[model samples]
Target: MTIAMGEKIFHHQLVYNDYAKLSRNFFNLGSLLEKIFKTTFLSKSGTQEGENTYMGNTGNKEIDVQGIFSSLPNVPTALFQSQCVVWKDEILICGGRPHNHHCYSYHTTKRKYKKICEYPHTIRIFGHVVVKCESDNNELTLLSFGGVDVSKYTLLMSYQSVWEKSRRKEKKKNEWRVVHHDTSFGTRKSNLTGASALIGGKNKDLLFVTYFPNKIDVIDMKTYHYVCGTGSNRLPIKSPYSLQNHCFVPLTSSNQTVVNHFLLIHKNLSLLIKYNEEDKKFCYESLPTCPSLATCDCYGFISFNDQIFFFGGYDASAMTEIDYIFIYAMKDRAWTQSKHSLPIPTRGCCPVLIGDGRFLHLVGGLAHHRTQAMHLATTVRAFDQVCFFFFFLSVIHLVII
Candidate 1:
């Protein structure tokens, strides 16, 4: 590097040009930036040179299991992208790729997995969204929507079928009956993953479903009416391909109005889109590029105490599961990398919050070889309790390290 002052010139070595110095600089910059920006700027999942390393405690809270040794007892075949829903005392694990309609139930009390009676006729079960919806009458139902049949490469029926517990005299209490199969609505796009969520609003609940390239199907949960359309091509940013395994989650806040807002996350994008009830248009917030999250897909996401937690997903460079964990505090509108992480590297797993948002039940997904279902609870104090001055000290410690 050279600097000139009139006729006098001085030459110096730029620190960034040196590979060894650059890596150290990045760590320092990343730590400082994390304190200010509140989000991770460098991904810690991959082991490549220059990537962030674990300098602090590399341990996490120990996981608790009730059933057999490492797994949920009698957990069926190892499946990826299987949808797990919290229903009463059991967690329902349903449909995944290679197309099977059998739904399994994991009894929390019995500590075992049992097959349910209802078998879906739909063939396109891969990469679909299965949501639990409750009606005013206290009727609980599980809805299965758009997915692709990988073998045939064909889009299954978009009209969802609602699986409800049978109340009939002859039917078993645990048996699920497909009561309503609405054929009016259907989405052409298929092979979509993590592109759907059942959002709750002040007036009524709504379902937001996304399609490949750029298409969204917004359905009013109460009336089953939907608005299906693609975004304008002239928009500043483009929607990622839905088939690529992006995760979409609704931000539930008391501050949110009758309209709903959601966060869309993918390997390359982090977007916050809001639904305008009046204009029926979607608005995007201008946000900085999400650091490590912008580079990987199939991460597990869950919202607890108004904060969003993203953890454990596949590392593209290594082509293996990662144990990274990141937290986004909604009140501060900031992100924080956590020293705490999953016991095992995992992806495609569903996080279920239990015991009044204290314990997290991680349902089965692909771990090293389809991890056994496990429970996680913070052994430390609540995050809000230590978020005051202690937060700054922790950030400073990372910078010093």
Candidate 2:
């Protein structure tokens, strides 16, 4: 290549005052964390993997499996989002299912957990959501919204069921309030996939949710007034889409809250979609395929260091093991493997972004009951052991490869 006379310029790597500082600042390095970030990966049957994959902090602490249905010998579990968020030095986990109701906070530094408050449901089954509420002090308020009533035995109900249930419980009345303003847009059947973001709108932090049925909606959060639709002419489907799994991440064109771009993680296909909000449509980009990974069954995502991280979900073939975490870098427009693995085999568990920048945490999902017969915390255990054993064998083909 020839340069054009005196107008030519030589290109060189731009030098910064401190290479180490810039390197550390631009990438996610887990070396700074002070606690053990470990979780168990259970096949639907809850059997321990012959070899445990060590996770954050390297597996050297006590696990707080207290009061949970863990004593069951073998039980089928639900596939739902678990929000295990960390703020500063504390980790907070909120609502999931059966006995997974109520919200709790943990001190990573202390390595202990304490229940902060009961979530809207006592016998909570599903459909709990969390979002940044417009509080004066910036205290995050988790929304205890509608969910499936295992008791309903009839058809799935509308979004209003959440408001009705909360009213009856009347617990956390001071801390929790109704999103009374927006429920007026008629009943929506969307159970949310991930947490809603309080993104910048006419105001700095309006709430946005990726409802399960394949659509997006925004609410004033404070006023509970419908702000508008996001990313396209049609909204994504609402949650529990017995048909599809959907995920969303609000991207930036300017400051972080800028809504011109969105990162959508397809619920089950292991595809990450980029939507251009200004053009009012999704971009025509092929999804990066993780042959060993399946997106069709993932729980959540975390974006850090210019790449979005996808963690545990069921293996691609319905009958495979649910035991790994995958990472995809945006610069290369492809997916790769993460050095991390779930503490145990897990499917239908929730993955949440913790602290900020690079830290993330994983919590409860349905796991199988452990059994050796020779060794039982007791004999007549709970859940179902036979179903779980078959569930494990079904997925062995996928994992062996």
TM-score of each candidate?
Answer: 0.64, 0.56
Query: After aligning candidate 1 to the native by TM-score, how far in Å is the CA of 292 from where it should be?
Result: 1.7
The regions of model 1 sitting more than 4 angstroms off are 1-74, 97-100, 135-138, 149-186, 189-194, 228-243, 254-258, 369-401
| Tens digits of per-residue lDDT for model 1, 287-344 | 4445776657777777766567776888776788877777776666777777556666
In terms of TM-score, the best-performing candidate is 1
Q: Write the per-residue lDDT of candidate 2 for residues 1-401, one digit (tens) a residue.
A: 21121222322245444544644432122211111111222111343533222211113432222211121121112224554544555555555654455555555444445555544343343544554433322234444454432211101111111212234533443243434432532134444433334354544444454544554555564555664444462343334433233445554332243343556656433333344434434443345556665335544466655566555565445654365666665556676654435444555555544344323345546444221101001001111122222233344545697
Evaluate residue 227 in candidate 1 and report its C-alpha lDDT on the 0 to 100 scale.
48
lDDT value for model 2? 0.41
The residue pairs in collision within model 1 are 38-335, 267-294
Give the per-residue Cα lDDT of candidate 2 at 264: 61
Q: What's the residue-level lDDT of 256 in candidate 1? A: 44
Shift in Å, residue 340, candidate 2: 3.9
